[model samples]
Target chain A: MSFINYSSREINCKIVYYGPGLCGKTTNLQYVYRKTNPDQKGKLISLATETERTLFFDFLPLALGDIKGFKVRFHLYTVPGQVFYAASRKLILKGVDGVVFVADSQIERMEANMESLDDLKINLAEQGYDLDKLPYTVQFNKRDLPNVAPVENMNKLLNPRNIPCFEAVAVTGPGVFETLKNVAKQVLVELKKHY
Target chain B: MSGSDLVMYEEEFGKIDEELQRLYIQTNAKVVFLVDKNGQLIASAGETHDIDTTSLASLTAGNIAATGGIARLLGEKEFTILFHEGEKDNIHISLIGQRIILVVIFDSRSSLGLVRLRVKKVSEALTRIFNDIAAKSEREKSEGKIDESPFAEISDEDIDNLFR
Candidate 1:
C-alpha cells in the first residue's frame, strides 16, 4: 500500500527484499545504502542476532526524487529469511507495495529458493494481497559463485511468470540498482493507473 | 490505491496537527509524533529538528511489530501500549485505532501518569479524526472525486530522470 499525503505533497511506498537465509538480502540493502547519496538515504537499521543474522528486519528509506510535485519516498525492508522466523516475515509484509525476491543462484540452494518463494506467496495471500497483482520481481543473486545454476534453468524453475528477473551479485552491486529501479517503476506505474 | 492506503488532505491534517500540538503542550513533551503501522510518518509536533524522525518512525513501527508478534505467541490480541525510560528522557508509545502509533518523548519535567492521562484524551481525538479521514476517502473514491494522479502522464524517461 502507498500513502499519499496531499497536504505534504509526498508519496510513500514500502518495498520488501525477501529470500532464504544468507541469500544476500541484507547485502543488497547494504550495497544500496553505501552507494546512495547521504541526502537520498536514511540510516540502515538491522535488528540482528549476536552472530549478525537478521532477527527481525532491516529498513532503509530512500528518496527517489519527485514525480511531478509529489516527493516520492520508498521505504525498503528485508525480512529475516531463516525458516523459523515465519511470524516475523509475515509482520514485515504488512502494507507492502512491492517485493524483490533475492534468490540465491548456487545449485545447492535451489530448494531454499523454492521454499522461500512459496512462503512469500502464502504470506501475501494471508494478508489479502495477490502477488500476481503487485509490483513484484525476482533477482538471481550470488552470480559470482562458482557452483551457480544456469540462468535458464533458474528461470524455468523459479520464474514461471517471467516478471522481470535479473542476475545479480548483490555484494558487489552489479544488478542491484537495476532490480530496484525496475520495481520502483512498476510501483509508480501502478500508482498512475490507480489514481 | 486500495482501501487500506492512507490519503491525508489539508482539512484532516490541520485537525491532527492541532491535537498533536495540544498533546505536546499539555504533556511538556520534547516531541510527539504519529506514525502508521507501515512506518510512514503521518504527522509530528514539538522539537523535531535535532532528531531523525524518518528513522524514528521506521524503528518505532518495527518495535511495535516485534512486540505484536510476541503478543500473539502468548495468546494475546495485541500490546496496545509500550513505554521506555532512560536516564534523562522517556518515551511513551501507544496504538491509536489499531492502525496508527502515538509516540511521546519527554524528560523529567513530566511524570508518566500525567503523560498517560493526556495521551488518553489525545488518542481519542486522533482516532475520531482518522475515522473521518477514512470515511471521506471512501466517499471520494466511490464517487470518482479523487484527484487525478500526477503520474498519469509519466514516461519511462521521466522515471529514469530520478536515477540521474
Candidate 2:
C-alpha cells in the first residue's frame, strides 16, 4: 500500500526484499543505507538474532528527492529468509508496495531459491496480492562467487515472467543502486495508477 | 503487498493530529505517534521535535509485527497491546483498528497504568476516525473524484530526475 499524505505533501511506500536465507537481502539494504546520504536516510533497524541473522525483519527508511514537490519516501524491509520464518515473512508482506527478490546465484542454493519463490507466492496470495500482478523484480545475488549458476539458467527458473532482472554482488555494491532505483520506479508507476 | 492505498487528506489528518495532541497532554508522554501497518507515520505529537519519527515509526511497526507474529503462534488472533519498559523511558504500542498502531513513549513521570488508561480511550477515538477515512477514500474511488492526473503528468524523466 502506498501512503499519500496530502496534508504533509509526502508519499510513502513500503518495499520488501525477500528471498531464501543468506541470499543477501539484508546486505542489499545495508549497502543502500551506507550509500545514501545521511540527510536522505534514517536509522537502519535489524531485528536479528544473536548470530546476526535476521529474526523478524530489517527495516530502513529512505527519503528520495521530492517528486513534483511531494517528498517520496520508501520504507525498505527484509524478511527473515530462513524457511522456518515463514510466519514472519507473511507478516512483513502485509502492506508491501513493491518487492525485490534476491535470489542466491549458487548451484547449491537453487533449490532454496525455488522454495522461497513458491513461499513468496503462497504468502502473497494469502495477503490478496498476486505475485504476477505486483510490482516486483529479481536480483540474482552473489554473482561474484565462482560456484554460482549461469545467469541464463537462474533467470529461466526464477523469472519466468521476465520482469526486470539484475545481477548483483550486494556486498561490493554492484548493481545495488540500480536494483533499488528500478524497483522504486516501478513502485511509483504503480502508485500513479491509483493516485 | 496488498492492493490497498492509504489516502490521507488534510481534514482527517487534522482530526488524527488533534487526538494525538490530546493524548500527549493527557499522558504527559515524551511522544505519541500513529503508524500504519506498513510503517508510514500518520501523525505525531508531544516532544517529537528532536526525535526521528520516521525511523521511530518504521521500527515501531516492525516491533508490533514481530509481537503480532508471536501472538499468532500462541493461538491468539492478535496481541492488542505491547509495553516495553526501559530504564529511562517506556514504550506502549497498541494495535488499533487492525490497520493502525498507536505508540506512546514516556519516562518515569508517568506510570504504566495511567498511560494504558489514556491509550485505551484514545485508541477507540482513532479507530473511528480511521474508519471514516477509509470509507471516504472508497467513496472517492467509486465516484471517480480522485485526481489521477498528477500520476499521469509524472513522466519517466521526472522519475529519473530524482535519482540524479
- TM-score per prediction, in order, is 0.97, 0.96
Docking class of 2: medium
| Residue pairs with backbone overlap in model 2 | none
Instruction: Report i-RMS for every model.
Output: 1.7, 1.7
Best by TM-score: 1
Error of 1 at A61 (Å): 0.5
User: For each candidate, what is the lDDT?
Assistant: 0.93, 0.90
lDDT of 2 by residue, B126-151 (tens): 98998999899888888887586356
lDDT, residue A31, candidate 1: 99
Report the CA-based lDDT of candidate 1 relative to the real structure: 0.93
TM-score of chain A of each: 0.99, 0.99
- Count of backbone collisions in candidate 2: 0
Question: Where does candidate 1 chain A have its weakest 10-residue lDDT segment?
Answer: A186-195
Query: What lDDT score is found at residue B126 in candidate 1?
Result: 93
